[model samples]
Target: MVKEIERKLPVVHVCTIVPISQTVGANRIVPAIAIPHPLGDPTKTEEEEKVIRRRLVEKALRALQTEITEQTVFTD
Candidate 1:
């Protein structure tokens, strides 16, 4: 589980719904695209989708490196 892993290592919860993540005690959260396509957008070209996914991944990476005392949502 995310909370279990987070006890030792930082975990970034990338989900379409932020409220649910918070309810489950996700300290590091990243707002995703959608439920069906959390990391990709079907409306965009393949290359564009890749770029969007890359940015999302980068945000998660940043969240991992950040130090927080309370629940934090990283949005950029």
Candidate 2:
């Protein structure tokens, strides 16, 4: 799905596991919080978790804006 989409539009894959994203040909990858809750942390306060999730979403947006010739993982 990622590769096929990339052919027509820029795409970012936000996942907890980066290797799997790379294996599947995801060009832009954003490291996520966990497998069960990729965008959130249950241990955190609800408000805090929202902030974390927002940051991850912002990271994905940044990844979409970035230009790369090969697979890239945006950890920051």
Candidate 3:
């Protein structure tokens, strides 16, 4: 799906989690917290979770702005 989207919209940024990113051959990726909770950790307080989510969003935005010749993984 990501590839298809990219093929149709070359300027659009596509990013996914780690292992799936590898599997799908995604060129842009952001490390996730986990499969079940990719953006938030259940064990964390609401404030902490918000911070985590914000960081992930920031990483994704950065990924979209970056230019790369190959696959790239953005981490916090």
Candidate 4:
């Protein structure tokens, strides 16, 4: 489904629980926190979590804008 979607769309950013972006064959991947809480860490304070989430979102947006021929992983 991901490959098919990529074929139709100009850009697609994928967020994964583990470091399986390459294994899954995603062209653009944003490394998420985890499987259950992909956006937040329970150990972090609310403010810190918010910052982390924002940064991840920004990275995803940048991945969408960047041009690449091969699979790429965006990290903090």
Cα RMSD, model 2: 0.7
Candidate 4: where are CA atoms >4 Å away? 17-19
**Candidate 2, after superposition: displacement of residue 63 in Å?**
0.7
lDDT of 3 at 18: 68
Highest-TM-score candidate: 1
lDDT of 1 by residue, 1-76 (tens): 7789899988999999999999999999999999999999999999999999999999999999999999999997
Clashing pairs for predicted structure model 2, backbone only: none
After best superposition, candidate 4 residue 47: deviation in angstroms?
A: 1.8
Residues 2-75 of candidate 4: C-alpha lDDT, one tens digit per residue:
67688878555546553565776778888888778888888999999999889888888898899988988776
Off by over 4 Å in 1: none
How does model 1 score by TM-score?
A: 0.96
Per-candidate clash tally: 0, 0, 0, 0
- What is the C-alpha lDDT profile of model 2 across 15-56, one tens digit per residue? 998999999999999999899999999999999999999999
Between candidates 1 and 4, the lDDT winner: 1
Q: Using Cα atoms with residue i matched to residue i, what is each candidate's TM-score against the true structure?
A: 0.96, 0.96, 0.82, 0.79
